[model samples]
Target: MDFLTLLQLLDTTVRLATPLLLACLAGLYSERAGIFDIGLEGKMLAAAFFSAAFAYSTGSVWLGLLAGIGVSLVLSGIHGLASITFRGNQLISGLAITMLAGGMTVLIAQDWFKQGGRTPQLEGAARFEPITLPFAETLREVPFIGPLYYELISGHPILVYIAFALVPLTWWILFRTRFGLRLRAVGENPASVDTAGVSVVALRYSAVMICGVLCGLAGAYLATALQAGFVKDMTAGRGYIALAALIFAKWRPWYALWATLLFGLFQALELRPDLIQQVIGVKVQVQLLGALPYILTVVILAGFVGKAIPPRAGGEPYVKER
Candidate 1:
């Protein structure tokens, strides 16, 4: 309604969008390489648990981040082995990874911490604190620019900036590099890529590994930066939302950022129900607001928004002789 209120909304949108943006990019990389990964949620969940556990034990967030990335990479490697090496069904393998992470995180958490699937509360160096920008204090008195800079952009943790910065980097990598060209070619036509003297399996494996690294960072941000420690299923379907976002963006990096931000805005509104009611001057149900992301996903899939064409070789195992 007002300028300050708008700034607060934008700030909340950025915070909520960070993980979604990360996970969406992860999915984009994997799917663009012809690997349909439904296990992004699982990887994030497992990484969050392990990162929190290690951070609490060692009192170092950096080590926790590395542990998270390591665990995620291991799971990604498993997916790669099952689907690429064994040539199994990619969807089933991804589902298995998700189920495995879901059960394993809780099981290990209870056994180690005895807190019913929650790690010990993190403090001090185990957590990420918001960094204040250089001119935040001095520019607080400025008009529209002041709140935009000081309130919305200046107070987030380091990972938030990294997540946003990744958009352009991803765009460049997917469009401007030789590897990017080969990766896209493989997804569209693995046989053609193979004929060109490139290893399809190797390229797909690399993409999945990058996905794992990004998902690991997303999980670490959730456990250490957004919250003090990991909770059971803290990801709470953000992975699925990110997948939907990937589809919504049609696998484009810049569009993925906008899509994640739109979903995040819905989430921010759900968190502040009164604000929605104020804006619309009508009573709004929180359940309806919460369901917005899933509804959008279904609509996009049903072609209400537009036709979404996936990579030609997506969800298919590449056979050299086939």
Candidate 2:
């Protein structure tokens, strides 16, 4: 393929990667604190539905974003309560959240809008629009750099920039701060943290709630920015894909970018079958292309891409001694 075509594919890759990046990072904070949450997908789906519902009702995208985050936070609290407060099974609690979000979104959409299982198409101010960068049009003819700046690097929603920018911030927060040290410590050995005069439950809850906020952004971006409205199961297993990415990256911040971007490329390729045909000289099945991400997930989880050892105390309930 040519350079411009390659740039176009990359543009799509960036767009598709944004939500995954957000959700993957969400998982990172939760798992890193010893709370094994598999409910990222549920939180995203619930957020997507509620955000769209609120935005359509209020005609304000900001309200919708807040609603999304609010719903995700509630779900995160539920996860925390089940696994932390009650010391229940973390996996079961998380899976229950996913199932709950899946059914609740559709049921509520049909009850509220009567559109089978989707919200009304968001319009005007209720939806996010692409913002052109300051120098994009001015530098459109300055050679390769101009087009690269204009087409690939510019004209995206604010959240796209936010998602990519979080990479460094995540690394900094996880490594450079006192809270980061405690969070990692809590995940590795909660007993030690407790002995050090720290409340392991508090740190784990904070991490899970942070996970909720990021997942909220992911869902809002999906319903308001990427698509015009919410549909049934719009997340389409992206939460699971993000979990796989978390494992693939061995739970590192910078590596999450590469892993999500790699999965995002598959998503982009799914939309650009013509590009695939050009490179391979044959039209490929859409189903086959769509399965690429899942295949990678299985491969990574099966220890194919090096053993991804999770946190030592992951998925274990911390029991304090008398």
Predicted model with the maximum TM-score: 1
**Cα lDDT of model 1 by residue, 34-152, tens digit:** 99999999999999999999999999999999999999999999999988999999999999999999999999999999999999999989988899999899998898888899989
lDDT of 2 by residue, 1-322 (tens): 9989999999999999999999999999999999998999999999999999999999999899999999999999999999999999999999999999999999999999999999999998898788899989999999999999999999998889999999999999999999999999999999999999999999999999999999999999999999999999999999998998898888999999999999899899998899989998999898987887777767777887777789999999999999
RMSD of each: 1.0, 1.3
Task: Give candidate 1's error at residue 142 in angstroms.
Answer: 0.8
Q: Looking at model 2, which ten-residue stretch has the lowest summed lDDT?
A: 292-301
Candidate 2's C-alpha lDDT? Answer: 0.94
Candidate 2: residue 306 lDDT (0-100): 73
Query: How accurate locally, in lDDT, is each candidate?
Result: 0.93, 0.94
TM-score of predicted structure 2:
0.97
Q: List residue ranges in candidate 1 displaced over 4 A.
A: none
**Deviation from native of the Cα of residue 160 in model 1, angstroms:** 0.5
What TM-score does candidate 1 get on C-alpha atoms? 0.98
